[model samples]
Target: MDKQRDFVLRTIEERGVKFVRLWFTDVVGTLKSVAIAPAEVEGAFSEGIGFDGSAIEGLTRTYESDLLAHPDPTTFQILPWRGEIDPTARMFCDLTTPDGQPAVADPRNVLKRTLAKAADAGFTFYTHPEIEFYLLKSDKPGPHGLEPVDRAGYFDNVPGGTAHDFRRRSVRMLEDLGISVEYSHHEGGPGQNEIDLRYADGLTMADNIMTFRTVVKEVAIEEGVHATFMPKPLHGEPGSGMHTHMSLFEGDTNAFYEEGAQYQLSKTGRRFIAGLLRHANEIALVTNQFVNSYKRLWGGDEAPSYITWGHNNRSALVRVPLYKPGKSQSARIEHRGIDSAANPYLAYALMLAAGLKGIEEEYELPAEAEDNVWALSESERRALGYRRLPSSLFDAIRYMEESELVAETLGEQVFSYVLSNKRREYEQYRSQVTPFELKHSLDII
Candidate 1:
């Protein structure tokens, strides 16, 4: 800890950074910060910056609001996206209450608690996310209404596509912030792109995700464009998703990997996948929280509507990826349904809970569906014991509200808060009459 503190202090002095932002996130995963002079960093290191927890979403209520933003010195990074004249730096924070207990409702705290459970079970959770998003001309309504900035298709490298430049800049910025990018490419939809981050522990990956969104938007704004993580942003095209690859570790050994096992996945790995599929419906509200999120899920193509696992089937929600020869460490399950807009901490917590439950119960994994599940008739799917995910935000909430696993996983405070918030959103969505209804059926009905 002293080493990091000294490193940050010395870096500030040497780099001539004018402001050091103490960054944290609200419960919904929106990044928040309070800037301090370099001289105040020493004090911040010893005692955290004080803030009103009541002001932050899903934080404390007004009565008991005092909170602390204790900076994690390990997260310190100079802002490469910012200007050089008055260079800025930042670090992620851990929240605590006045009495120094970890804030119960903090999203990061939620993940930590889950991780602690995994630690007790002698497993470490690791995650790598392939996050997709769109770069729009602007979010504001235009004469022809909202539109995509380009008409490019999958992997089309336009000579000077703003998307290409934006992605290059975004990836570089992420590297500068200590996050490694494995790959970046244009996606199926115009202006849509995917950036895959290298695998890391769950907590670090969650922090990286928060930083990733900010860096993407910051670069988009600088390039006179806007980035949206909205699932199904364009009705006719593929939507953004955060297809997460996950595995368990015991020290340096990969728990999911086994030599000569089917797809190189161990028995424990299969159980974990079973757990995810078993509890998938109950946790859908967390994975696909937004109203439009369901739209993407049900939409044809890569979006997974059914709870099934496959070796290589893109339509299945959970895919056991093919193992690369001699790459035992890379064996992991890819969860397909989670969207980019979710609070990563909460999403990850629920995922770990579900998977760990599978391990504990020794749940039997279902047969892999090699053929496309999407092509099967509804009746056929039913006969095969395949179940569809929640069809709407309301449906997801209905399932989540009754989940003891979710309640236990998120604890009392967050489980209730998320359910209440999601219900409110679903209610509002149900009450609204959209342009689709008006344009298609207004006169006909």
Candidate 2:
């Protein structure tokens, strides 16, 4: 830890970094940053920097607002988007109380707590998210109403197209920040693109996801295009889903792999999938928190709505990708329900916790749904014993409220805050009279 801290301080001075931002997240997963002068970086590492926790969303009560942000020197990276002259560096921080205990309300701490459970189980959880988003001509909806930058669909590489170049630049920026990009391609929707981050351990991956969004938005701004992670930004188009690939590692060996087994999935892997499927509805509020996220699930465009697992079935909530003949380490399950808009810290934590619970409990894997779940009728799906994910934010919240798993994974403070926050959001949405209502009701009623 000392060596890492010294390296960060030395790097900042050598690189002439004028600002070192201590980065953390609120309870809802929004990135919060406090910039410190380069001279303060050393002190920040040892003493920690103070911030008003009450001001941040779902962080603390007004009376008990004092919080400390201790920067994790291992997360130090130069902000490549900033000016090169002085340069700016950033580090993801661990939030704590004045007395130095981890803050219960902090999103990062929530994840860390969940991760500790996995560590106790002799496993390291890793995730690779295929993050999808849309590029728009402007930030606000214009006359055409949130126009996509290009009409090209799904891997269509037009010569000198904005998306092609945009992706290239975005990949470069992410690489500069030490995030590895495995793949980048245009997605099924107009102007929608997908970038798959190379897999990393859960904590590092959460931090990377946050940085990925910022880098994407920054690159979009530089290109005079708008970037959105809104799950269902455009109607009649594919929604942006963060289809996450995950696996458990017991040291260097992939714990999910079993040679000669069905789909080569180990018993541990099967239980993990069972845990995910069983508790998916409970975790929906965290993974797909927004009202619009439901649209993607029910949209029938590869985003999963059904609670079932299968091998390479996109419509199933969890799909085990086909394993290479000799490459057992690459065997991992892909969770297709999570939206790109989710707080990765909370989402990933819940996911890991749920999976760990399955392992601990020795959950039996359910029957695999080989048929496309979306193509089946509701009755057919129900008859096959498959359940649907929450249809709306309200439904998700209700599931979350009833979940012992969720309540345990997110401590009392965050669990209550998220439930209350979502309830308010749903209530506000329910009270609103939509444009669809006005357009139809004005003529009829």
Poorest stretch of ten by lDDT in candidate 1: 22-31
The number of the candidate with the highest TM-score is 2
Q: What is the C-alpha lDDT profile of model 2 across 382-418, one tens digit per residue?
A: 8999998999999999899999999998989999999
List where candidate 2 sits over 4 angstroms from the true fold. Answer: none
Q: What TM-score does prediction 1 earn? A: 0.98
Worst ten in a row by lDDT for model 2: 137-146
Residue 384 alpha-carbon offset, candidate 2, angstroms: 0.4
| Model 2 clash number | 0
Task: Score candidate 2 by TM-score against the native.
Answer: 0.99
lDDT of 1 by residue, 389-424 (tens): 999998998899899999998888888888888888
